[model samples]
Target chain A: MKTYSIVLLLCLLTPYLGNAQENFIFKKAYDLKVLGRVSEDTSHFQRIDSADLQNLPPAVQRYAKFSAGMNVVFKTDSKSIKIHWKLKKMNTLWNMPSVAVNGIDLYGWNGQEWQYISSGRPNSEDNQMIMVENLDGKMRNYRIFLPIYAEVKDLEIGVLEKTTLSPPDTALVPSSKIAIYGSSITQGIAASRPGMAYPSILSRRLDFDFINLGFSGSGKMELPIADLLAKIPAQLYILDCVPNTLPEQVKDRAYPLITRLRMLKPEIPIIMVESVKREISNWNSAMYTRVNGQNDEYRKTFDKLVAEGYQNIYYISTSELMGDDHEATVDGTHLTDLGFMRISKTIERYIKDSIAPLQ
Target chain B: MKTYSIVLLLCLLTPYLGNAQENFIFKKAYDLKVLGRVSEDTSHFQRIDSADLQNLPPAVQRYAKFSAGMNVVFKTDSKSIKIHWKLKKMNTLWNMPSVAVNGIDLYGWNGQEWQYISSGRPNSEDNQMIMVENLDGKMRNYRIFLPIYAEVKDLEIGVLEKTTLSPPDTALVPSSKIAIYGSSITQGIAASRPGMAYPSILSRRLDFDFINLGFSGSGKMELPIADLLAKIPAQLYILDCVPNTLPEQVKDRAYPLITRLRMLKPEIPIIMVESVKREISNWNSAMYTRVNGQNDEYRKTFDKLVAEGYQNIYYISTSELMGDDHEATVDGTHLTDLGFMRISKTIERYIKDSIAPLQ
Candidate 1:
């Protein structure tokens, strides 16, 4: 009977093991948490308020204002893990809140119930670190319940699987970042959801980091803002502020902005983008005129840069990017989700073929 | 003295004729007129309320509340122009009003003062046309205004000068249009201004008619939407809905959606976009796992389509698109305007090299 039981257990484990092998082993899982606090004190929660859930999707809406303290679950399969978290405190005027994690809530669950483990707030600057020997081999799920005062703007949950057991010495290093300075369209005004934004979409596709400085109507390529941009560390800098500016502004700002960014990070790739064609009557006659003027200015800048021996700068024409399709835009000025995808793919290829080679 | 005066007049005329050769012509202009009615009648104005303007940059905030009796002006020169105009009525609903030339505030300087020639609505669909003669010869600034019930969203003005005039029939035609579909990032959410969006930037560079269809969070690859897409005529269709869908959803819908669109337009180009990398703790481990699974399924579908002898289907990998920059995202998920510009430029090159050949 014992032998038969052992064989049966092995038989059952075969499928599970096969699935484990087939599962693409992502980076070793880590205990990732985010903590924040409201800038000020607030009343206790009684029940999940519908109004609080307004912005969330239906799946997570009901849990918006949990009164009895809700348990947040995260799944992972690693014996050791690292935690990266952020703690923010909001003020009265600014509703943004910070979340916190207590030592009691960090627990290791044996199959039946969650077993309390150790926890503490991480150093503010060194928010990420590794853990060892705390996890069991069983599918581990990390759960945390908040004090109902904090709001989580961004959170990440990952598991450390052991196909690769050793963690890198420098784990959780910041990913390479691409920075775009542009107008309203970059701000994600019309996209259906936050995650669906093209930048978000591109991030997922390319496995990199991004910074969106898309001020809705504020991408004027002014010197002040360009000064701010010069402070950032980026692998690529994209300058596309011509749509909102008049031709004179385009002529005035385009070259200087490009030159400024290049001056700051001489080797970093700089791409100057012109505006897309708007859906207006007499599509060809009028649209091309403005486009050409902008491009001419850009070209002149590019030529100057080239003459000055700058080699890393590039220019992307609008016609090829938009492909003369009128339906891609929701309004004449903004792109629909479809338009973003098309442009993202085109960008993806360019980065791979052109930029990636340099990297 | 009389002979000297005649010579002076002739000399002035000679310079005027020479100046005509160097002016920029306003090839075609489209005037978008808004008729004001009671705030209750929202149908007349494509109403965009204050809330809609909430996300827009300061420049466009005033124009967010588009009510009836608001006149919006859009114009194009031989190079670039504004194509689409969306407005909000006083009641807080967004509306798209028909644009006409007659309603434009046309003014001509009668030697002493700038007099209003006409302020009546023009028949846009019928006899809607504005032609400027000898505009390039003299440096003249033309302004178009749209008065919204609340405030103005955008005002576009173009300068026309005298130049070699090409007959209207000789005007250049838009070679093709690239239709992009995706999410909020594609829609230019959170960007400082409208024109800064990557699509707009890319459009300005390439000089193609751009149709932006980026809904905030609604790019789910649903058949109902696909049905609507099938009706439109386009040279290229870029499918970028992955950011808005889960891996299972992508597997289930991607192939079908591509196939459906292909069925409608057999020869049109269709490009499938993968999602961008998210700055999750695991660096897109889980999302990538899901994306790869979906991509595999999509590739298989593409193979099947090819086997069935379908052409013009392409895939753009995300890795090549974003380069090594991961910090370009504002959050881990969404991109800053800087990121959009980089992505747009990258895509612009890809489309130019790949699709331009076919075109």
Candidate 2:
């Protein structure tokens, strides 16, 4: 009789043991908040069709389009979770299908093979909110792969049946977060694969997050974008819109752009990026002068920022970005993947030792 | 009789003006030497085709494919002429056609517009020596822009038209050279234009000569490539090949790569680069292990080198490069142009402060 009891006990505990061994579980859900309004013009927003959210990886599963002011409630049974986000104003440029929220493909390993979960797309209506759910519960440690610009008001968590709530992990590991604001390059255009870009490589090296606000050719350091950037947080902000801007425009906008960012995030590091040199030597007769002039203006702004008790502002010389040996660049404008990596490494080191510690 | 007398007076006076503006012409031709060969097979050595030489910028007119051997020669009538060059190798899977240099194209600035002179596809069997001649005597300060690899052993100038050589009113300034070696990102893949690549931008900022030997997916720190790199004189040698190599591979190669470069050029500054993190989760899996292993190996190597009296080596963590945010990357690997600019600035400052002085 005792032997029979023992067997039954073992049988009863087998299911529990299996559940424990399956470590992957959802933890908690949060209410994703958006402070903006949906544009009345539906054409200005992106409408996501019914797709398989399960196809996306956990990192990007929560990215879904919704109307503005709509609450995205994420539910999980896990305890504490980390959050990251970004936001941008809706404009005509943002309405294009190609300009929708990109770089949100997520993947996870299912022991033997990697599986996809979900992806993010622009909302169909401007000023609408895109929300994600089941993020914290889906993975133990969560990472939102896309650059989200909405306001993150609060997070909610709950302990599972066999789990307990724990404090968030905040270890001082060597990490970095670079915020890139520019045009198509910032949007990962023309790369053979998404991961082959320099920024992606840099992120892999640094063990940090990235906020890419590249809006195709539409990204400029305009007031609307800068205002949006002011709300989110980052360790460094890289401004690289000169390529899309005319020289006169750069000259007119460079100083104001730096000043705006400095005013918002006084202590964060800001690296002003210049446009790459053109392959066509004489494409723009005033390119040299305009670039030089904009550079000088940036310098002046940096100096001014430094003078105004903002110590982390710096200017990255445009020449060092490409053509150092003149072989890394493709047409004197865009870089090959190798060129991007070379340039990213150079900047990665500077930010790690020189900029991040200040934060 | 009066016209002949006037012409004689003009001719006599012309000599005085020509002599006044005479520039010093070094007698010996510039000696451009090929250091050594780097190829999987020596039987198919890469050589510069003379026909292709006509396609280079007016400044870099030469016939010489860089091949293994120290016997290559470069002759110039002026001691300081702009050097331009092009080299070809097999393109990789991840390489984009926009960034590949399969043939040579010539560009010239015609005061008001830039003109395409010629383009040539190199025939493997051609034994033509590249040549650069001053077709127009009006080219006062010959500026040579080398788009490819052709080493300069020495430089010389010679008198033309029997005129005595004197220093020209303006002198050619030799920009500090920055050499970078890495994978596809370093090769400037996906960049919309060549100048948009970070390395090129950095060059423009620093006014430095750039040598971009970024091989797409080929920067595995192989000994042959390193051997090639060792022969080139540079202010800085950036090793950013981690993204192209698996973490395990990086672990195996990082130390040896650094050690070999140090062995070849003891005094040159070698910046060791760490791989960037992927936006995808599963941070504790093979990717993390590989990256961390490589990074640890690099650190250990750096420490060992420093312990062994190598003080010039530096480390740039990937974290600092990408910042803590996750949006900078386009598709978990490559960077948007904005990301490229950020990285370019970071490295530019480091080069300016750390390596520029040495150069």
Candidate 3:
């Protein structure tokens, strides 16, 4: 009778004892190998230089602070993963879910490809949540993508007791980057999650680091942004800013930006993208005229640049970006996960076929 | 000089005059030809019978009021579309965007196919917004899908003052319905917008009314739900409730539900679907076991039914639903637009090849 009672007592206390033994070893994100950054900002996860904030426009500065394409890559042999993160501020978007705007997307490398495990769903400015658990506890490579539209104030990764968590022995992605500069779409405005963004998807598919320099409402090929792009040393540069630039702005700004970027990086490949066709323009005549006008002006600029004997320069039209079904966007403008995937596949084809580094 | 002054004054008053002349005629949703309904509840936009609500579980009753897959189809010559809507209550989900949970999706049929125009982004319980403006003044077919997760209190459509807003000259979709009963996924839990739900996508592609009988957490193949489903006069019935039912529950309940449904509707075709393979299960052993166990029990029940000489019955496995990549879901469970599109395409292929009515 005493043996049975003792056994029952031990069973009742097993869960609590196991929980007590879960000694979590937390690692600051600053100590990890971060990807998709061109500037060394003071903030741990920002995309651009902290010093450039004062010189740039307010919107650009604010958007640059978001860790749109930043991710931390590490190796761990833990059965569980947990995160305690604090956002710079609590932000909400009408068309974007909080999971995309303020969440952590974790993926595990399964030999050949990265597979999604879970997302850290945020509840407030500061949140602590278990991302995934009950793993087989093999030493494996893992990448955790940061929030696409919000800034992280602080981040710490937690693993089970006595588990090994260290920097990866080999570089998973190449050091050479494909830097993309564009509008809100490039900034991943309406992706279902951060990892579904076009740049992140392309990085996973192409096995290269793709830097995101997308500035929401500010990717107008302004000289300030162009100068910033010229400073980043990348193997390839893709300019996809026609959607955010007016026709007159395109004619005025496209030539100087491309020319300066060419002078700065003499032999690097550069691809120019036209404004994507908007489904709303199918019915609204005014929007049709405006978007088509922007594209025409952008095309003229590209023709002039080609005539000037620019080498290793290319242009991509809108015809091949989003599919013909017109169901890829949440609003008439912002691309959803479907749109992001479609666009990324198109870009991936270009990178694989034309760019020597990726090939 | 006096004539010039009058011309300038007229030009200054043009916007106000146009605004005053832009009279809108409003129509209640009850006056339109609505689709994807099995019951004639007093509410203009509910899926189930109001009387049956008292007898069902609270979760099922609450979910029944949500007008998932319900849409209004009409023809109009108005150059713009506007809406004034009220919700039963303001609700929010961690994984779903507000635009999907509470917004309205509008699609206009061109000569060949339906094209997405814009989404009515909701602000509060009582909301008014212009869905689309500056459309070409042509008599066109339009369909407006309602919120997927929120119940509607009242809805009204507005068009140009003199333009006709009448029922479609011919039925755009067939009269026969394909009733799909399942969990929150069938209710379009994490879709980016209302029209991206699998049922909505299938309706557009197949041109048939695909009814949504999904209860969020209550799709346990209960006898009451089975009886309710049996009463609906559908040409085909798809049982997709395995995700919400445990192995034991499925073993105890699936046979009775199928047998009862078959006994009532002898000729109607039935399709039983295995639970979808969740990406979370790839790394988590507990989830892997649970989901796989549910599918195994469901398959056994299906095999039993087929062996018992059940004619016009079929089964669908989970292998071909979401793509090999694990990026289809916002969470590891509820699908995003990408996942919804993929799953809908898979189902569409099955229907086209197997279902006689659709073919």
Q: Compare candidates 2 and 3 on lDDT and give the better one.
A: 3
lDDT tens string, model 1, B238-317?
A: 77666655556666777788888888877777877666654332222333354455456656666787898877777777
Model 1 TM-score on a 0 to 1 scale: 0.38
Weakest 10 consecutive residues of candidate 1 chain B by summed lDDT:
B93-102
* Cα error of candidate 3 at position A103, Å: 0.5
Candidate 2: segments with Cα more than 4 A from true spot:
A1-359, B1-174, B281-286, B356-359
Error (Å) of candidate 1 at residue B259 is 1.3
Higher-scoring candidate on DockQ, 2 or 3: 3
> lDDT by residue for model 2 over B1-359, one digit each (tens)?
56643432332111111123433333332232221122212222232233333433332222133221111122223312222232443221112232222223233334332232222222222212121222343433222222222222232333444343333222122335567776546655423333444555564445455555554434666655566567556667888776655445565677777778778887888887776554432232323333455456666766777888877777777776765545444444545454666678777767766775674
C-alpha RMSD for every candidate: 19.1, 17.6, 5.6
TM-score of each: 0.38, 0.40, 0.93
lDDT of 1 by residue, A1-359 (tens): 56643432332111111112222333312223211111102232212234333433343333223211222335565654444333243211000011111111234334444333322233332233332233345445554333222232322333454433322222222246666666545544333223234554454455344455454444667765555556555677767665555556667877677777777777888777666654432232333354456556766767787898887777777775554534344334555444566667766676565467576
Candidate 3 is scored at a TM of 0.93
Q: How do all the candidates rank in terms of DockQ, highest first?
A: 3, 2, 1
Interface RMSD, per-candidate values to 1 decimal: 18.4, 16.8, 8.3
Model 3, position A2: C-alpha lDDT score:
62
DockQ of each: 0.02, 0.03, 0.43
